[model samples]
Target: MSATVQTPTTRPQIPVTVLTGYLGAGKTTLLNRLLTEEHGKRYAVIVNEFGEIGIDNELVVDADEEVFEMNNGCICCTVRGDLIRIIGNLLKRKGTFDAILIETTGLADPAPVAQTFFVDEEVRAVAKLDSIVTVVDAKNVVARLNDSHEAAEQIAFADVILLNKADLVPAAELVALETRLRTINPTAIIHRTERCMISPTEILDRRAFDLDRILAIEPDFLGEDAHEHDDAVTSVALRETQPIDVNRFNQWIGTLLREKGLSILRSKGILDLKGSPNRFIFQGVHMLMEGDDGKPWGQDEARDSKLVFIGRDLDAVELKAGFAACVA
Candidate 1:
């Protein structure tokens, strides 16, 4: 009798949403609402203990960087040895939960947390990057944006940004703050709220990783191309109509990231490669980058590549020259 060989079952990708905000932006309050609210969804929250967040759920993990199997049948682990390990452990018990929400430290950059889903193969296969929801203190954003680049970065990387504490400021002030945020990241969906009052659907299950939607959402920075600066941190957009040599482009980007990753808060690009019929889309946080083939270039459409870099003190002349060298 011939032995039957069986293949491993592939689990459906669970969405992981990252929640970020400044220290006093009511992130904890919003998180508390998500946890204690009567919403039917179950969440495994990885929170910082120093923050005054109240997690009443049985799946609430400890603050330390260690792994533990909880009594509630949920896997609990701190974001140690990379989120890949903790997330991999969670996937092992995929039957216990519906989704995952990770709350980064206040004043922390969301890039590292966002990069985890892209950098790890195992985690990427079983989980989809839902969206990054950044909660901002509307009354304090002016001072915050000026005080720290971390504040600016949190705002820039957001898929959905919540202007919390909106009641504290006047309507005109609110409009002005919104305009400032839009200039930094015109693509993000902004919602004004009092005390972080936002619907769960607005943030959850957002297919942000879908490149086709991303292409439409990214703002047309090329037309005006007026450089906006938030202290040392700023955003740079690069566009070229020519197709690039794949190997040379990769080499340049790899080295660039290695040397300047610390300064680069976030990076994203859509490429037109010389030999490839399909478009190449890539984004990175610091030195870690992930890229894949996106949609095909139609015969009638113009073959143009666009790249955006959000960093501190990025040399446009040098970077643009490096990119131009890669033109096929």
Candidate 2:
């Protein structure tokens, strides 16, 4: 007797795009462009502001979360924790919006924010990270790139880069900026826009990030020893076949972030938990940490935990030991 086969259905999750750039780098303008665009997709905007006064009330589509004002004037530094919480809450109201666009403050690096999609279990389950779209100010690209590590990383990790305010720069200068950006990241799709205006299709669902690309960017990431790069950046990856103690893992994460938040740029992992059949995901940028349950394990799935850390001058020995403490 022949058996009938049922086709698998694909339920596509909405993607969340994190828009970041240096201060006054046209992030807001690009956001406004997205909001006002005639495109049919509805987006729920999460605005992280530096000051208590919210000036762009007219631009906000729906104020789901109060503008989380950070003390440091940098969204990555001050509002990262708030971002995790907001995203978690947003996931609960999944039917209300088609997609999510998070506008980070200038001076914020995109790595930590991107890490959230991989680490936080709840956020990961509901929202897939679509892209890290960095808007570069064409006129001041050289200066910002020279002065800020955050600016450089934003460009480095971006899947799509918008050279905004292109009209302000000469053609030759813009070309030079493109060359510089290529050296930092050769794979990102570059778009030159005037006043941060570009087609929405150009930015969304680009699938710019890949594990292989990330590993290539930090080759020593998977190595056993700690490797430090320029600007005191370091990467370490931990892998284990054993499960982790949930309580110990939570404590270690809190302590590590509290003490080394400034130095820790990004950390993420798929964890094997003692009592959980599904994979547990953990991710953080600076002080913000988020995790959630991942897909269920199949009969042939490998039960192992793999975590990667990228930061400034991180001590590999100490990190490994701390992670080991979480072992069950």
Question: What C-alpha lDDT do the candidate models reach, one value each?
Answer: 0.74, 0.69
lDDT of 1: 0.74
Error of 1 at 122 (Å): 4.9
Clash number for candidate 2: 6
The 10-residue segment with the lowest total lDDT in model 1: 69-78
Give the root-mean-square deviation of each candidate in angstroms. Answer: 6.7, 8.8
RMSD of 1: 6.7
lDDT of 1 by residue, 94-170 (tens): 57878888777787767656665665567789877778889999988888888877898898788789999999999
Q: What is the TM-score of each candidate against the true structure?
A: 0.79, 0.57
Q: Candidate 2's residue-wise lDDT over 117-169, tens digit each?
A: 65556666667888889998898877776676877678766778999998988
Screening candidate 1 with a backbone cut-off below 3 angstroms (N, C-alpha, C), the clashing residue pairs are: none
